[model samples]
Target: MTIGVIGGSGIYEALPLENVSTKSVSTPYGEPSEDVTLGELGGKEVAFLPRHGEDHQHTPTGAGYRANIYALKSVGVDRVISTNAVGSLREELPPRTLVVPDQIYDRTKHRTPTFFGEGMVVHMSFAQPYCPEMVGHLAESAREATDADVSEDGTYVCIEGPQYSTKAESEFYREQGWDIVGMTTIPEAKLAREAELSYATVAGVTDYDVWKDDSEVSLEEVLENAEANQESINAVIEHAIRTMPEDFESEAWSALEGTINTPTDAIPSETRERVDLLAGSYLD
Candidate 1:
């Protein structure tokens, strides 16, 4: 029962661990952003993957969400803890604040958000996007490791972006009372639900989005805040790994029992082997 850690933006370097080995995993979806680094952290086995390539080569839209999650699931990672750097939509969630968003408002226009494609069809309940148990564990670990402002829950507005939001767009999100804005959470959260893995995000507030009349958001500001908060983020991940339970039950795992719509005989031979580990039990 290994744990998975996905590093966002400024967190490209591998998590600090002892006895680490990098492994490459192939998934039906495609190649993951980077090789999975397997190692021991706080007496627990863990795997780490950088969402963007180590050099930040992948754009938000180009990040292989399906392959990444599939690779982790294939390697037996039952739960995932991801770290993201995002713009704040609310004034109080200023730079360097830590947020564990409970909900995601997906405004992303491009990207495949599921694994049951090809000839297969499936539906996953995403009403509660993030895993509740994982959220609590992440938040508690963050609080114990950092003195920075940490929030347990908020509405994360996920947008399609290789470009930052326009002022009007930022203002619109604020009007909707969303707590944070970012480019990566949509399919990442959505796909995790389908994979039946407990997933949680630890978002580091970088800047107030362009909506803030007092100050315009800038790359420099975002980078600076992200750099400052990176240590705290790492601490929370290490702590969470240290204390995580070995086994757990969730509606997420149970929900997969009936989600597969394609018949075993109807599926192509290649497709069945490709997706078997994820949804094979439900098929004939």
Candidate 2:
């Protein structure tokens, strides 16, 4: 089984996967952000993809959430661990902290957030939103690798952005009990579920959102923290890969079962072949 790591923002490069090689791939959805880096990590074959193009040209809305997940699935990835840079919503969850969020509250408005389209439709169960088993592994790995305080349970608010939040908006999220805020993750997580890949997020908190009166957020600050904390993040990922069990169950894996709303006879043969990696068993 191949594992996938979707690196966000500053994490364009992963800790050198042993015997690494890069391969560009195409999926029915579109091109992925960049060529997938394939290599071995902790004796397991792993695939790595950068959410944004190598130059970070794609905006959050422009990132092809559908194509990205599909590309990973195409390459035999059954589970994915996504890294995100987030803004802190609560005071206690300060800047430079690490969090493994268990839930996501989507506030994104403009983005292609689903794989089902045209004649296809699906209703996926997202009660937990994240893979609990994966989150638990990440939490333990983070604690072992970093001295920075890491929280196990958090509610992430995903916003539509190339812009940071307004004070009122930030405060509103805090009122909703969200621990962190970011512009990505929701659609990517949702699409992964649709693709039948177990997905989890390891969020790196860069700054206090607009809710903090003491200091405002900035791109420079975000980049700086991401750079400083990367070593710890890499360490955690390596440890997680090393200690990951040979086999485990993920409720996220079964999320798409019985959720397809379209009749099988109505599905186009071309789309079926393209998506066989995700739903071959169900379709058969």
Candidate 3:
């Protein structure tokens, strides 16, 4: 019954850890963001991984989405809290604010985003991409842990980029009414559901996305703001781990319940081996 914490930009170290030790795990997909750091936080067991490499080696598209999620699941982590740095599309949600976004709009183009493929076909529910249990627990923790105000709900717009959005692109997103924008959440959120894990993201607003004529987005600016807000971000996660709901379960996912399209016996042996940890029961 361990909880997983995936650290994003300007957040590579796992805070408030006790009895910390780094554990290396290799999944069928490959190695997770570096090694999984096993430790105790908030009276519960935890597995922490840097979403990008230790030196911030991977970009959003370059991060190991499948391997990262798979490594956590393999270590018996059924629930996850992912942290990200985002640009605010609306002025209502200002920079340095913490947000638990309830909705997601994917505009990303280059990522696999799933663990199931090959001879077997499995479909997952995307209606509520983030887990309700996670959202509730995360919000409760943020209220007590951070001095800053935490937005309970908002819509996240995911883009494919190492580059920040252009002014025209940023303006268009505002017209679409998206609350926040970032690069990594699409497939990371999508793959968590496919693996039958409860997942949520805590987005820290670092800029206004170049839409505001007075302000423009830049990596140097994003990193500076993110560093300023790291203490609050770290506190929310440490407290959230102590408050996670005990009854949280992924068994209610109907799309994952019986949605395998291929006949169990007909799945190719190689394909079965690759996805055995993911949808093996359906293929068996």
Candidate 4:
């Protein structure tokens, strides 16, 4: 099975993939953040996509979440591993800690979060946003492959941002018990479930958010820590891909089984064509 990777902040270049080639995939939603980089990593076929454009041109809210997920799914990717740079909401989970989040809280208000809204209605089970099995594998990989603190499960509060949180907002999230905060992950995770692709993220804490009295988030600080965390993140990703079971199965693969509400016959032809790659089997 081909593994897909969505590289977030500070991860602009393609992974160290052998026999690398690039494919420009056009999705029904739009263009992906960039062309998909295809190659082999640790004896596994891998497709790496930068969540932002190659030069980091796209903002969090501007990144084409739907197109990115659909493009990966189009390329025969069954599972996706995402990397993110986040701010710590808790003191103990300071900078450089790698968190494998099992839950997500969406604080995004503007982005399109689904591919089923226009002509079809599908209510995906999102109680557990990230794939549990994938989360386990990622946590295990981080533990074995890097010396960074590996947090098994945490709630990642994803806010809509090209901006960091204000002190008040940060404190509120802390009160709600969210562990780490980041800009991406909401529509990405949501769309992955809709696409029936197993998905999980290894989030690296880049800074202590403004919740801490003297601490404040800054681009320089975030970039520095993200750079520091890159080696560890890369190690964990490689290990996970190298050691993953060939026949690993996930509940996410059948996520759409009973989720579609719009009858197949009622779905518009254009909309059906748009979602064909994702729900054609069920609709047929």
TM-score leader? 4
Q: After superposition, how far is residue 161 of candidate 3 from its true place, in Å?
A: 0.3
Instruction: Assess candidate 4 and give its TM-score to the true structure.
Output: 0.97
The models' CA-based lDDT, in order, is 0.86, 0.84, 0.84, 0.91
Q: Candidate 4's residue-wise lDDT over 1-284, tens digit each?
A: 99999995344242567898999999889899989988898789998899988888999999999999999999999999999999999888999999998999999999999998787899879998999999999999999999999898989999998889999999999999999999999899999999999999999999998988888789999999998999899888888998988878899999999999998899999999999999999988
lDDT (tens digit, per residue) of candidate 1 on 73-102:
988888889989999988889899999999
> Using Cα atoms with residue i matched to residue i, what is each candidate's TM-score against the true structure?
0.95, 0.95, 0.95, 0.97
For candidate 3, the clash count comes to: 0
lDDT of 3 by residue, 12-70 (tens): 36476789898888887877778988888767889888888887898899899899999
Clashes of 2: 0
RMSD values, in order shown:
1.6, 1.5, 1.7, 1.3
**Clash pairs detected, candidate 2:** none
Residue 124 miss distance in model 4 (angstroms)? 1.2
lDDT of 2 by residue, 69-150 (tens): 9888888898888888999998888777899999999999998877776666778788888889999999999999778789
